[model samples]
Target: MNEALTLISFGENGWGDEIAKGVIVTVTLALATLPFGLILGFIIALAKKSQEPSLRMAANIYTTIFRGLPELLTLFLVYFGVQIGLQQLLKLMGFDVYIEVNSFVAGMVALALVFSSYASEAFLSAFRGIPQGQYEGGYALGLSHAKTMRLIVLPQLIRLALPALGNLWLILLKETSLVSVIGLSDLVRQSGIAARVTKEPFLFFGIACLIYLVLAIISSSGLSSIERWSKRGDATR
Candidate 1:
């Protein structure tokens, strides 16, 4: 216990401060991106299910394009390509704006794009699994389609997608490491910094792993609570 506490001490030489800051940034990134990705995923999923062939094809293309590419390539494309694209657009507008995309923003956008692609599949499948009779019943009760989706479909979809979402959260966490390639000072990046400074990969990397484990455990427990709450009404069944 003493040894462990000593390891976590906030001395000038210790990595405690860096690890804490990294964890905060990582959690912030994850939480901020998760909701946005879910919204985008739902939209894409709805698009995929639409009767319009064009809309459905567009969504299908978006999912396939994102999901098929390597995450590393996706990060690079978003990071540099978006910047270049912005610059070109600005040039066309006769504005000399030196647009520098924020690392946090770029990382979130890249991760969200990938997350939404995968999440759309899970969410769409969940929505499909819901009995058609439920929607009919909802219509019979005078609920608007939007109201039925909001009050009925979404709840069930979220409950059903919780497990996949949890797994995606973990994947997102690991993928954050790749953002280090784009110069985001995430956990892995910070750990590399520490290693360079301390010349002790063992200590810094070990601490980083522990931090990731803690974050995963905390996320999993929170998701478990969400799962429980979502299913509370069906406990009797």
Candidate 2:
């Protein structure tokens, strides 16, 4: 037990510092992806609900394709295919530059696409849960459509969507591990390296698992608080 502890201890003979850096990368990637994913998902939800048939069809197609594909495949496409495409485009433009997509950027894009696809469905459900009367009420108040949605509809939509979105956030957090396959040096990758070098796979991997569990627990607690706060007005009513 002493030997195991020392192996992970924070010093020259241990893997602690490297593992800590990996955790940071994992978290930073998730944070970087969140807003883009949520905003894009919200936009996709709007598109899915648009009166224009083409817009609705396009949104549906997008969600279907992304949600249907395996996430690893999506990452590969983004990491490699996107890089190739960009290189080709640049060459065509006479720039002749080689383009290599950063693993972090590629991971963020792929995960955002996947997250947004699922989030759009959740947002759509929330939109449906809202009453038509709200829109009518806003119109009656002489508010413009956009203003009504922004001022009145959005708050309720978020309240309704929060639980599902929270669940998605947890899933997104786990999915960050997938980026390690693309050489992102995230938590899982660092643990793998430590395990290999120290010849203690179970110990390092077990530590990695515990860290992930802690993150999930913390995320759940925070999300629950946000959910309750969002519904505070409803509670008063």
Candidate 3:
């Protein structure tokens, strides 16, 4: 017990600071990618429901390929592939500088890919859940489809997607640990370093677990609140 207490202490050898930093990095990376991912997801969901066959096919292929691929593989493709592609573009312009993609960017991109896959599905379901007659009524009232979606369908869709998106956010936090594999010193990686230095695998790994559990609880509570709010307005309907 004393050893366990000493291991987590905030003195010169403790991992309290490192773990805190890790949590920050993880959360920041998740937030950084969420807006972009959500936009991409909504667009893909639009495509999936598109009137055009070509557009629907494109969306189907994209979602299938991305969802089928292993996340680590996708991470490699995004980080290294994007870096290489950018470098080639620079090279074509006769620029000689090396382009570096940091772990934070890589992690965000990877997690965003996952986020978009699930978010697209959620949005698609939300889109279908809207009554067909609502669209017809809007059209009868001379409202454009775009306007109808914007004013009527979308508000409810946002409410419906909120809970699923919240759950996705929790997964996003956990998946940030994968960034450590790409050489990011996120929470898991930081704990790993301390474990190596102290030769105490159990201590560091256990601390990582505790951090994960605490984060999970906090995230779950947040999602529950959001879910309640989203459902609150539905009580009478």
Candidate 4:
């Protein structure tokens, strides 16, 4: 209908612009969370592999706690808890300046925590999958520790981890929707607004669903390419 078209039309009279912006925000947040989560997860994996029992125990506890908590609950706790704690600390210091936590920052931190928890397990498994003979061979070749890791260990580890990491990326993309719950103007939030204003929930929500499907398809295609590339060395052998 012309009416439905108009509701999604570009310009001040419609929500097309808002929806576009929301899509961008959602993508940006997911991308931002990716590196931080991977780095933290890498650290946790190493910690668990460490000889120090204390370090291993600490890493285990961290993984258990974050992995056990629901993502939404973690978001709420990080967002509101940090905000309240910061305000209280500022009051105690007599600064009196009001500080508000940015929803984007909170979302990034919370999601990163959740992402790392899951990713660490994948990384740890990849680490363990490397054969002991590889390390011995590297040392026999007179390679230093760093060089051995870079030359012999990393490539195989990445190949092993890529599939799981790609899957996690897909999950993270969907999880970005949860950020909308905390007032981030992500795609779902924008669509909800449009639906409420236009009184056409089905139209707007259906549009949102299609958009997400397109994104997932695109992501899956890219992941497939990466997986193929990772396996190229094996394929040749």
* Candidate No. with top lDDT: 2
Reference-based lDDT, residue 130, model 4: 99
The order by descending lDDT is: 2, 4, 1, 3
Clashes of 2: 0
| Candidate 3: segments with Cα more than 4 A from true spot | 140-142
Per-residue lDDT of model 3, residues 100-134, tens digit only:
89878887888888778888998998888888987
Better of 3 and 4 by TM-score: 4
Relative to the unseen true structure, what is the Cα RMSD of model 4?
Answer: 1.3
For model 1, state the Cα shift of residue 228 in Å: 1.0
What are the per-model numbers of colliding residue pairs?
A: 0, 0, 0, 0
- The TM-score of predicted model 3 comes to 0.91
Model 2, CA-based lDDT: 0.96
Whole-model lDDT values for every prediction: 0.86, 0.96, 0.85, 0.93
lDDT of 2 by residue, 54-159 (tens): 9999999999999999999999999999989988988888998877889999999999999999999999999999999999999999999999999999999999
lDDT per residue (tens digit) for residues 136-177 in model 4: 999999999889989999899888998899989999999999
Model 1, runs deviating above 4 Å: 1-8, 235-237
TM accuracy, model 2: 0.97
Off by over 4 Å in 2: none
Q: Give the top-scoring candidate (TM-score).
A: 2
Please write out the lDDT profile of model 1 over residues 1-237, one tens digit for every residue. 565555557887466787777777777888888888889998999999899999999999999999999988988898999999999999999998888888888889988999999999988888788999889988999999999988888899888888988899888877887778877777888888877876778877888898889888988898899999999889583
